[model samples]
Target: MKQWLQAFIAAIQFLTRIPVPVNVPFTNEVLKRSTLFYPWAGCIVGVLIWGAGLGLQLVLPAGPAAVLTLALAVALTGGLHMDGLMDTADGVLSHRSRERMLEIMKDSRVGAMGVIACILVLLLKWSLIASLMTAGAWQLWLVVPFIWSRAAMVWGMTNEPYARAESGLGSYFQGLHRGHLLGAVFSALMLSLATVYIMVSVPLEMAGWSASFAALAAYAIHPWWLLLGAPVLGMGAVWGCSRYLSKKLGGLTGDTYGAMNELTETILLLLLVLMTGWRG
Candidate 1:
């Protein structure tokens, strides 16, 4: 139990800028075990973002609130995943040989391709989030994408081989077993279900539905069933994208894993917006 708590803290520390109060040992084994709690770390991030969005909405319009929320999310993670996304774009869009691409990703300098990709991705995220906010559909359920995207990262780490032979951050995560994947998936699913229930209940209550009716509605419609599809869709997006990257690069790198998470989060948000008709 103590070891598991330490692993969870390690995961939180590694994944986000959030400080863990406990002093945890840093070891290869601890890092490997920390993968088990990556989804949980994402949950923490999602909750913080959701809280920030809610607070911002009190004083700001939907458009500005959404943009601020997005900024806060990026700031919270210190743009770690975004950095990965840029690195990936720099490499993959160069259209060079795989070796050259990898070298470019490893390079500290950000190329023009990386800058362009970052702008496009952030723009899309801002637009989508604003749409959701305008529709009042941005709720506690917003955490779903964050949870599943990190779970997808774990999936990549578990299923795909690390691209580089040299020591790096990605190397520490290689060789994870199926058990790690199962742990992440389980955590993600449980969180998803809880958020779905909250999402459904909120609207039904606003409509003056009774407690029993709200429970039934939560199981039946409004958001539960639709929102439940998010993880499934997110996992699918990650799997297909990761597979393509693997084929192109010969294996997955830390940068590709970050790219997978960012892409999955964006895709999931798009799906939710479309399903809810938020734009209309």
Candidate 2:
């Protein structure tokens, strides 16, 4: 139990800027459990993202809800994942050797490819979220996607090999035990079930139960569908990172995994929002 607590705290430290007191001794085993916390941290990020959307509804006109929600997402996560997304984008598109790719990712300079990917992704998320708000499926927007996005992050961590040989985020999580896996999976399932129940129970304006369920079906299908897509995408990321590491420095590092998490979240959010809009 202490180890689990320690792992949770470590996860909070690893995934967010949130401060956590770490009096617990640092060991490789503790760090391994910390990987379980990454998904939960994503859950926290998702909640904040939902809160930001809610706050926007309260403070701004409906017309600007999407933009405000997008801003809040970046602000809540301190754009940490977004930065990784950009870096990974630049690296993946570089089409250079592995070493050069990693070098490009590490470089602070923004390339055209990275900039364009970031803009398009953000715009997609903003537009989808706005459409959901416009259609008044606001509560579904608040919960289901948030849980799935984090779960997707866990899927990425569990399936992908660290692109690098040492000192990277993937390396830290390598070969995590079944206990850690169960912890992440269980937390994610509980959150997902809760979100689904709320979506099913919550009334959207004057919409009938049939219509609400129909509308929420999109969100319901997202995580399961993405269960297939995320692994494919995650594999691509791992492959890209691996190539970059092998060609450049002989392996992946922690920051690269950070890049993977960010990209995965962005894609997952965009997919969920779009599906929800269609159903709503």
Q: RMSD in angstroms, all models?
A: 3.1, 4.9
Clashes in model 1: which pairs? none
Candidate 2: count of backbone clashes, pairs at least 3 residues apart or interchain: 10
Off by over 4 Å in 1: 201-232, 278-280
Best by TM-score: 1
Give per-residue CA lDDT, model 1, range 1-280, as digits (tens). 9889889999898889887688888787888888888888988999999899888989999889988999988987889899999999999999999999999999989999999999999999999888777776667767988888888898888888888878877888767999989999899889888887886667676765676465443323245565567557766788899898888788889898889888988898787776655222
Going through the candidates in the order shown, the clash numbers are 0, 10
Superposition error at 152 for model 2 (Å):
3.2
**Local distance difference test scores for all models:** 0.84, 0.64
Candidate 2 residue 213 C-alpha distance from true site, Å = 8.0
lDDT of candidate model 1 versus the reference: 0.84
TM-score of 2: 0.74
Q: Which ranges of candidate 2 are over 4 A from the true structure?
A: 19-27, 177-179, 201-256
